[model samples]
Target: MQFKNIISGAAVLLASAPAVMALGSATVVNNCGYPIYFASVGQSQHANMQPLQGSYSEGYSQQGVGISIKLAPNNTVGGPVSQFEFTWANGKIAYDLSNIDGYPFSAGGMQVVPSTQGDSSNPTCVPVDCPAGQSVCTAAYNAPDDVRTMVCDENTSLTLTMCPGGSAKRSVEVREHIRYRVHARHFTVEQ
Candidate 1:
């Protein structure tokens, strides 16, 4: 009876050995919320990727201003990886404008209008305050208003007001709007 028990235990150990030694697959996936757009990737070090045995190289993508890498099976290798770096984008507007009277006040928001019919060569003028009696002025700025959620490509009209934060009264052609640029960035990690 003792000999039989010893033989059965050895057989069970032998049967599970192969299962324990079986290696896991390597896969990469984007677990991040942001996506990278227009990206370049390389090993963090000059030595290139020091992947552990049984591990494999996956791939990457540029979503908005974020970069995502995907892996399969997610196992095997010497150990976990370090960190990664990248660059990307944020949805922003850009343009030029000319104003005439009271500072342009559109409690609504600024509109980004594209044109080819109008004089494209006209030099973009600087924003200036209206002289006495002049209720209008002209300037340009990428609409920072939360138009993405409120309005979709709304026309950038104007209200001749005493100040930017003032109340709107009469409409005017000369708009003292703001023109500027925006920069966006993002990062990712792998283990």
Candidate 2:
């Protein structure tokens, strides 16, 4: 009888208490004038993430977790409106911003910036920091501005915005991660 009562009490308590799930936090900032929908490509394994933080942004989870968020301009995901918050595992990621279409006429571009060291996924990433208002695809023969790589090993903030005019992009990190980033000409992703 005592055992039964104890079990029932425990059940009640458990049922009353909310379920706490563990997830990593990652933030994507929008510095662009227009809105952008950002999505995180799932990794077979979540590398090594820790300490879940903030709510899921744009339906992104370590995997099989929460509803994806439809990111909008100025609105933030997995973080405050100003900056993005990332779970540990999701926090550390490698991404690049490049002009896939060598459209010589296109002037818009994106720049990938990271706090620590980062590397490019493209071998032909002839790193060149082209400022905003300038062109990355030069004459279609020459390579556009260098591709930008970012690695947020620690729980840090990553800003995704249009390439600023004549911004200097840097790269200095081992190819430890395999993430992809491609900036299409005046493009938006809806997934």
Candidate 3:
């Protein structure tokens, strides 16, 4: 009789173990703006981006176009919204990024105002100062008035954004976007 009772107790403990584990994971939480897309500084493997097909304003000027691409649902993708490799011939760019990742254009012309609005906003450094050994701190291209800006050129600048992880339930470590500013002329003289 005692042997049968022990077996029954073991079965009851096993049955309740699952319930306890399920209760531990019962709490649900989510964040909408966690994985934000900001400017990066290099080429991305995500080379299948298509054009947004519309004019987007950076601050006051409108020069560049926009596109909406399906960010491939993968965990291996990473970049700061750098130079949009627009394959105009192929009618494709690399990725579609409005809120996700992109460079907003000014209205006047190709002369783009460097600002940290969309992909330019997320800088890796704090406003105060860069840590020891670091030459220049990474900052979003915000100061259009200042000659030195992060978003100097597309070749040097990069685009970055967040994407879903390998597993939906698994938590992913967030990384900051790093874009290198390319050489650009702020003002020009027309003859």
Give the winner by TM-score: 2
RMSD of 2: 18.3
Q: lDDT tens string, model 1, 62-141?
A: 32332212111123212221121222223211122222111222221122222221333322211222222233222321
lDDT of 3 by residue, 2-52 (tens): 999999999999888854211000000111222222222223334443332
Question: In candidate 2, how many clashes are counted?
Answer: 25
Question: lDDT for model 3, on a 0 to 1 scale?
Answer: 0.26
Q: Write down the RMSD of candidate 1 (Cα, Å).
A: 27.9
> What is the lDDT of every predicted structure here?
0.26, 0.35, 0.26
**Model 3 residue 68 distance off true place after TM-score fit, in angstroms:** 3.5
Compute each candidate's TM-score over C-alphas: 0.15, 0.31, 0.17
Off by over 4 Å in 3: 1-63, 72-151, 161-191
Q: How does candidate 1 fare on TM-score?
A: 0.15
